[model samples]
Target: MREDVGEVTTSLHRPTTDSSRSKPVRYESFEWPQQQQQPPSNGVPRSAWNRQHRRLSRWHRPYTAVLVFLDLISTLAASEIADVFLEKSKSGFQHKSWLFLQGSALFTFFAYVVLPLGWLLLLWTNGTYDRRYLGLGSEEFKRIVRTSVTVVAAVSLLAFATKTDLSRGTVATVSLCALLFILLCRVTARQVLHLARRRTGHGAHRMVLVGTLPEALEVYTAVTRSPAAGLIPVAIHITDGYAAARGIETPVPVYAGRDVLSLVREVGADTIAVCGSASAEPGELRRLAWQLEGTGVDLVVAPQLTDIAGPRVHIRPIEGLPLLHVEEPTLSGPGWLVKNLLDRVVAGLGLALISPILAVIALGIRLSDPGPVFFRQTRVGHDGRTFRVWKFRTMYVDAEERKATLEELNESDGMLFKMKHDPRIFAFGQKLRATSLDELPQLINVLKGEMSLVGPRPLPADDGDYLGDVRRRLLVRPGITGLWQVSGRSDLSWDEAVRLDLYYVDNWSLTYDLSILWRTIWVVLKRKGAY
Candidate 1:
């Protein structure tokens, strides 16, 4: 209720899911100061749910205040550092010197008070400090950029409107430095929060999932899979007779829907997340909201929407009744042209930047084997068009010919072939493969317009594994590294690989591409699931 983003509690004591029982119930004593049921059994001195929620509620404001303080300090430090640097530049900054001499007090006020306060105001106006945009996602970073630009625009407007004389170089330096510092500080803060969440699910809300068996397990799996910036499912409240369904296998309890209030009290739930299946009619849901008025728990109603990106979603309120609107995915036209342009430019520069490394790798390949330095294979690209994809040769010359002999040793599913210790690979090739240096040659294909820097990975042209309705993958050009590459590579199941590829195809955007490219660096460094 205080702020929206996150909150949670911790305790080793948790509920157990009983498969055979009608409802998995915990017998923690439930009592009110004055109760009428069963002679008022005494409650646990302090339930985990209550303790966790209380901590979440109490610390929400203080935590947000700390974030705001960090922003202000970062802004001031950047301005001061920029001031010191600009004082040394001597690039027509005589105006600053004149200001110091003629308006020393004004200069002090401008540097120490006005600019910093103005920055804070601009950030607040731009929603940089809003709880809804504070943690995770590029929205926060974008807001910071917007705030900085808005401040610059305002300054330029003032200069034009009032003939205000200012040092151009100093103003530019301060603006650039402030923007950089804000981004750096925000990124660092998110890293710290991520580490905290991963280490211990702190700053995440404790959730009571209210849904039927199938629907409840969906939410449960989603929350558990990504614990960072995720809801911690404390308990599952199933509809009247569906509690006995064996969908869930967690220590989190399953309760009858009628026992929602008691379960919430017992588990110290901070939020009640009502999934579409369990969120009765509008009238019933409204009444339920009334029933939950002062419980100190946030009520969230989730519509049954899946796999839709935030940009395509709009919530329209017609006469105070919320209606969901979903825009179809953008698959072509101007955006696609931009994605292609970025891919080519970045790939061109990438190939040039890494030419030295490529040469070294080529030398190693020549010394290791007498075959060609590049391995060219036909792979399907945009619109099912086939193009030759290049990679540093990591296999022996006759490896393809010997494929039949090792067919029995295949360890991978789908059309793809993978073996941890395949005889086809050269000794030096293993290191190259493990380090992902073998894929560097694909940048040439990327530069050639046959591939993109980010998209679904291209499979072998003759490999018809994903050619059904999943041809949706070929709607865009293939990529050497993509959702599949970053999401565990060869370790991903066939279904999982297809899912990731399709998700990329369906929700492609410039921002999304950049995010994946950023993630790709970490994934490559770790060599997770690579072989």
Candidate 2:
């Protein structure tokens, strides 16, 4: 059995004797292997792993900062050449060394000095430079790109509105160059780090995996693929009796036993990565915690949650229990204000920009069907209040009657309803839904204050009534587009849908809302998970 008592056992010596005088006397010396024992030391175990991690984190940022600074300086130099070329073409190839010098200096100041500084501030705000992000996924890259673009965009707008006489061509040139160089540099750095990690077989923290074969395999794949995360699975402890076949062909050795602590120490891992059910009793997990209290090792529990972002999960300690608090998603309070304001402003601009297209869709719908182009249905909204949710009619008027016949084919779980390939969709409705054209009229709902630009998808009364204890989805104003729609829409399981809504509810922030909006554009463009 695995042990965490800081004790090791060797074969014990036994005296040979016969109860009766029938057996001949045998003299033998058997020496077992020596067992190493720790000397009496401090009660608290030292964390060599933590020290290494912290030290690496300290050096990571300055390295990236230097790369960013040098890249921007290179971009400024490129912009100078581009500006000189444009000037010569405009002024009969005149040799204006003074003009070139002045333009180059200005570009250097704005792109290299100002823009990088602004990016640094934004990165600080977004936690982009956090040590935890160092060995993570493309998330860090995405954040860097986002922060850089935002800074450049802000500067551009400021230059345009304030008449700063900043050369627009030079700004664009430098911004594009800097963005490309930064992305390339980051990608190269990741590749180098990945190679180094694999070659040395160091940097990765050893892990004792506790789960069934299938779950353990999944965890193993995740850790192996993400080398930068530094999670290395050294041993897997299967709880099932010796009958189940191992699911993964991992280089790491596998052992079956009930002693979790022994397995942890045997594998030389302080971190116990729990993935699935184990042979140990449920209370054993807590008891193991007690055993490792001052061992300076972390117990990392990997829940079955997948594809869920961290911002959505909330931990609330309740009555000495660590209760997970999932908030219902809504667009209200300042979010409501922001969405309402954006709705009016963007809608007005869109109407002015795309009046012809809106006119075309209206005329096409009118021509296709001899009914109202706008379909409004009663949907449960914030605080369980009902509102008329508007959409371009993407179904025949008898779609409700048809739904009753398809109830047996409903694919979704709990109160939600969905079908992969529904028979009730109108001729153009399939195209409309796939491209998210049906959601356009909801901009009117946004304007009417019945909906916001982003929130949980407003559910109809039939589904809402069947919500049982899961109807916390109505806490905030209904949204035109929401976490559900962008995430997987009709394809998501009921639990996942509710979990996402709860995540949005608990972590409501303007930044999150904007992120959702930005993601919505991609979701719509991709048309993934849409029926």
Candidate 3:
């Protein structure tokens, strides 16, 4: 029997003496030999090994079943909706019999049986149900989109080859509706899984950390802070020598890295994350890979590269050696032109649509406070240029005068000043800040080319001129709402906000902008991290 120590179980190799059995074995007392030994090939029995494989399958099987069910329902419902809409239209679909199936009866057979099954088959072949990507990342969604396109292309080709007259409207509507439904279902499923991981620690990977004390600690801090990543560090192996473990403050038990395979087996860690320069040792990582071959364990390498998105990074293999090629940040070119055009167009339409709300806000501010309806502040913009950022006033006229007294209460670690409840904000101003309604006036700035719909938030000119890589954020126009705004707003530390802003500047894309805009809506609705 094994003893439980917090979330991690104690080593399984404790002595079975009477005294030892009665007393719990502490994690710090566990030790391994300095010399590395080859892992035993047949340490676990064949039946037990098979059971290990079955355990993983058991975890993902239910989720996969749920996905399959959802996909079937979505496809069938889409087909039925298309059939009904087309049947009711003036240009009614001409139904033809195929495979001994006329009229609405033939359409019903295809809708109820053929379309759903074919969609499932295509999705399966496209790896949409792969366990590795089922509830994580955007790979699953990409596969679903690719499969949808394939379905449309395949149907068109088949109809042309057979010289059969299939209604163009039916094919287009069913395909589009099915794609939307599947994508929605996937997004919902991912959110539910993330919630479970955050609240209950369910579906988390039990991982062992391997590297020097500092590197391992960095990885540990990152994973623990992000519960949605689902990495639970159970043990640490100091690769710089066990002496490096001295004076370290780690939440998990620390052990010598001389024999990683033994440590993993003792703790039952399903994943091993080699951090920082630990993999640089010649043949060390290769040897670890050989050891993990049939143990049903996953090996992950955490490269030092941080905050870079997937589109910017690519693997280029030359003569069997894989090298990472990071593309330069897109600061100019056709993409920037498109982004600029989009910003102006969106801002123009938004201002037109919400002009009434803007007027009401202006009136409320005018009545609530004795000041200008709009506040203008000089802020650093693209290429170090300064511009007046406009916003519905959310503070009293004397707010600036009171700032000197509130300086000591500022909680931010960096240049920005932040307070959860500022005394200068009136009752109505607080509501405006919470719902971000005060920011609606920035559409005018975007339309005037002084800002963007999505980019780094402009900082006050008093924040000082940015130097080094931080200046990269000024390559693009400042925005009304950005990554920093959606992520945490005033709640984030100064360094974190800068890091998020820099990341946005380096990895800007149209799709990325769209995703940020979508998340911004939710952030505003939830009023998360708002002052």
Candidate 4:
């Protein structure tokens, strides 16, 4: 069980895991145009919308059913495997197997029936099939983990109380294996639904955002981009306090404050999402919920805190007043130690595994340019300390001296000076930059403990435009690849780049880091946003 928890840390994937680029499709200042621009009639009848909601809401029953089947299969498979596995251990160390075999040398009938039934009951009663966890698989997956842990704890206590001999190794193996199968079932199901949505726009909950322009647009971008979340915005209802005097045009239908309910009926929007500004008022939302009672429309409230994930936020109700608590991010903990250790191991393995390529790159760089093979520049590190970040030189030795002459050609955002076709690099150097081989040598800094395998990109120490509140990102070691690497590399805007960096620091986890690493593989290969 310890090894199971350690292998795939739940903290690896935070509850608010969103990997998409979340920037909104903003327009000129919204003028709150008079006419309610209805959704273009796709001829998708209103009955189709109701069927979609039914599928989304009740998907959990089938989801849980699949879980039960997978658990049964996992139990049978683990029994066979564990019996064989623990047999060797038994012969070697006088251990017991997991099957609870009777005198006939076969499993007891109760093992097959009682245990599987218990699993289903525990899972169901523990809220694994809750409506809120249906489409988006994060919560559903988490509940499975919670159920497995709690059951294991209960079994351990029962064994101790009854003075029954329980094979710790066998129990751990079956629990972990069963969990693996259950999650696999959920992942496969969610992907099927995601494919349905992508191909046909089926099984998604249509939404209408009601709030001020800027904040509403933020929510709009999030829901629209994250189709897997099963929330899609079909219309907008701008409220007061928006910059309505200025002209603005939304990509979708726009509605007035009074026409939100009518717009929902017009488009069959199942979710009435109330975002920031006047629409988020308690009295107003209560009234909205009251109106939505029998209409089958769900009311969702998105808080002003953007980009923060679920684990950090807690709702505490005291005297009927609910208060939100946000846990501050800390860099010092056992988790940090695990991350630090993982950084060195992976970086070392990475360098060793790619030694021949590193050598070949070294040879190519030396032959291409009659200068240093390595580029070392001062970069801001954790807590604002400066370190010489290493990289395979992908430019001429006089790259810095040529900066002034190329200042007029800068195409990058903020204070970042970049040019897609910069003349400063040697001929072969451009390929390295394009393929991201130029940053490979930063693995050395990672091994040297000056950087991490995944964290914010280490920028030049003198880059001042984004040095304000973003300096908090310096609280952890910089990385060779990060949200920036998989996000858009150098193609991201100044604000987007900083936002990704800050988000990484705030949502640091082994799972998040591994995801970035995995995405980096394809992002680097395709060179999508590389310049």
lDDT, candidates in the order shown: 0.72, 0.63, 0.77, 0.70
Error of 4 at 182 (Å): 3.2
In the range 1-531, model 3's lDDT, one tens digit per residue, is: 112222221221211222221222223212222332344443433464343232321346767888899999899889878867665653443454231222457657777787789999999999999978876667898899999999999888887998877777778888999999999988897788788888986667778888777888888877786687777899887665556556656688886523556556567566889988876753667666756654567788876767787789999999966678999888889989998999999999999999999999989998999889999999999999999999989899988999999999998888778899889998889999999998999999999999999999898998788988778889889998899988888888888888889999888888789889988999999999887
lDDT of 4 by residue, 401-468 (tens): 98989888898877688787889988789899889998888898999999998998887987653457
Measured by lDDT, the strongest candidate is 3
- Which TM-score value belongs to model 3? 0.87
Please, what is the TM-score per model? Answer: 0.83, 0.57, 0.87, 0.75
List the lowest-lDDT window of 10 residues for candidate 1: 1-10
CA lDDT, candidate 2, residue 178: 60
Off by over 4 Å in 1: 1-63, 89-103, 157-163, 243-251, 291-294, 405-409
Assess candidate 4 and give its TM-score to the true structure: 0.75
Give every collision pair in model 3: none
Clashes of each: 4, 3, 0, 4
In terms of lDDT, model 4 sits at: 0.70
Candidate 2 residue-wise lDDT, 461-510, digit = tens = 75536354356666666677778877788877887777777666655666
